[model samples]
Target: MTSSVFITGATSGFGEACARRFAREGWSLIISGRREDRLQALAKELSSQTEVLPIVLDVRDRAAVTRAVDNLPAKFDKLTALINNAGLALGADPAQNCDLDDWDTMVDTNIKGLMYCTRLLLPRLIAQGRGASILNLGSVAGQWPYPGSHVYGATKAFVEQFSLSLRCDLQGTGVRVSNIEPGLCESEFSLVRFGGDQARYDKTYAGAEALQPEDIAETIWWMINQPAHININSLEIMPVSQAWAGFSVHRKE
Candidate 1:
């Protein structure tokens, strides 16, 4: 039987990649995103291989979240996994000079949004009582605090702790919690962080190779597809060319 996956932030980056990868593996997908166009496009792209359901939602909306999950299609009610990949980095500026709106966006989307979705969807997984998984996307920034990534890093750090704690709490319930942290990933993260600053986005990975969305998605797939006895507690992935947080190399002339 094919497993079903419910994923937030499924329109782009790691979320989109995971949607495609899992579809290729014959998993039915429940994909949610803020952009209707992107969500529709993704659904169309994956419909050929696997069953795809696209939901236009903003994870920050608690009421909407509750309503959406409440109204899930019959097939999605049988979800085997939930991927909390719908978060964003607002600004990479020091706290003192940081934009309050940016900080709020980070906290709202990265932390509260995740809690809201997980809170609503966890009961379904628990009731299934077989084997289930939750994969949260974190970042190396969570481990290494840089000058301009104060709140962004803190958010991911919370994910790490939350995942560990949830795993222990769900031990007897047959549900596994895993956190995947990617360093220097190639994605819209930079554009979103800089508010669509083309120059800054261009320079983020100018001279070096970075982890691609596929790489992160593959890590998520592996964790979800693990043997029954094995649970991937935590995973941190960085491209071979990228060493660590804030350690990217520039072209030397």
Candidate 2:
């Protein structure tokens, strides 16, 4: 009973971790990422362990996304699960001082991109009927607001609320939708937060145990494997050291 799983943003972070986690379970993996080389390398590595097909795609480009899905070899077309994990925070900027480019990127990839893929896959998943899962990668910042999260938080908030509506729409269908809200994870998050500023990146995690990408991957796998009758609509996973968006400790002892 092997299932097929498709993941966006498989080059790094939670998506990558999920690829490894699912591959170990004998699930065939359809990994997608913007970086061709990274995707190829990961595909090669995972193929040795399990069935894997890597695709290079930029979720922001609607045409590219469509091609990526349509070009999937028949063997990988029947995806039992799809993880919408291609996202990032371009800059930690307040609304009044936000970078327009950053805002555009957030809107395009986090909001528009997720919607595009879901729209394209909805039919495929529904056609399969029975059992299919859509896991959306979200952030706790959407729940608890922060100072410099003007656009990032808004995008995640959209994902959070959208998943709710999607779950309601797929009521009778056996399709499951999960909004995975993560608090803190140490996987180039800060670097992305500071926009490649190495100095600023060095300071975000001075003394705190942040959740790792693998942690979220494990939780996602668990939610999918739960009893068939259960639908994990939402999951809020945060590190013990992270309290909320308002407060985060950065000093040890």
Candidate 3:
């Protein structure tokens, strides 16, 4: 049977890259995103490589997510992998200065959205058996604290904990669960975080030699292809130029 992978946020960034990567392997693709035009364009482009099902969906919408998953076609019903990649970080402001709406968006997308997909798809994945996997797109912000991380980081922290805990609950099941924490990636993600400030986006990656969507895609590819007996609990990736900031000290005048 041909393997099928359902990827959320397939319009751009790591999600899009993963869709391309899996399609190249001839895996049936169920790609979902909020942008209908972009999703359709991607499906058209990848149709030549493999079977593609483009779903115009906002992961934050529970009813919509339910409809999409519940109504999967027979051909796409047996899923081999699920890449929960529909997430975003808005603003680079401290908690006190941050907008409450931004926090809510982050929670809805990064935390709740991921939860909905994972919960809804677990049965299919479990039925698919040993080689099935769940790959969550987490961030270094979840592991390390920074000035402007705030709610974005907290939501990712939820992802990390949820992945680990879910693994425990799924111990008997052969389905694998992994959370990938990435640092300093250059993609449209930065643009969204910066509120579509092109200058800020450009400046963020100007000379950082940051990780790209393809890099994360490659990591995910390796992870899902691992042997059924081997479960990679978690993986953290950072570009060479990126590292932990030692500490912050305040000097009062």
Better of 1 and 2 by lDDT: 1
Ten contiguous residues with the weakest lDDT in model 1: 241-250
The candidate scoring highest on TM-score is: 3
Where does model 2 exceed 4 Å of error?
245-253
Ranking by TM-score: 3, 1, 2
Please state the error at residue 127 of candidate 2 in Å. 2.7
Superposition TM-score, candidate 2 onto the true structure: 0.93
Off by over 4 Å in 1: 244-253
What is the total number of backbone clashes in candidate 1?
0
Quick one: RMSD of model 1? 3.7
Over the stretch 103-154, how does candidate 3's per-residue lDDT look in tens digits? 9999999999999999999999988889999999999999999999989999
lDDT of 2 by residue, 85-165 (tens): 999997776688877988898899999999988988887677555678899999997888887888899999999999999
* lDDT for each candidate structure: 0.89, 0.87, 0.94
Each prediction's number of clashing residue pairs: 0, 0, 0
Compute the lDDT of residue 202 as modeled in candidate 1. 86
Clashing pairs in 2: none
- In candidate 2 the C-alpha lDDT for residue 223 amounts to 85
Which residue segments of model 3 deviate by more than 4 Å? none
TM-score of every candidate relative to the true structure: 0.94, 0.93, 0.99
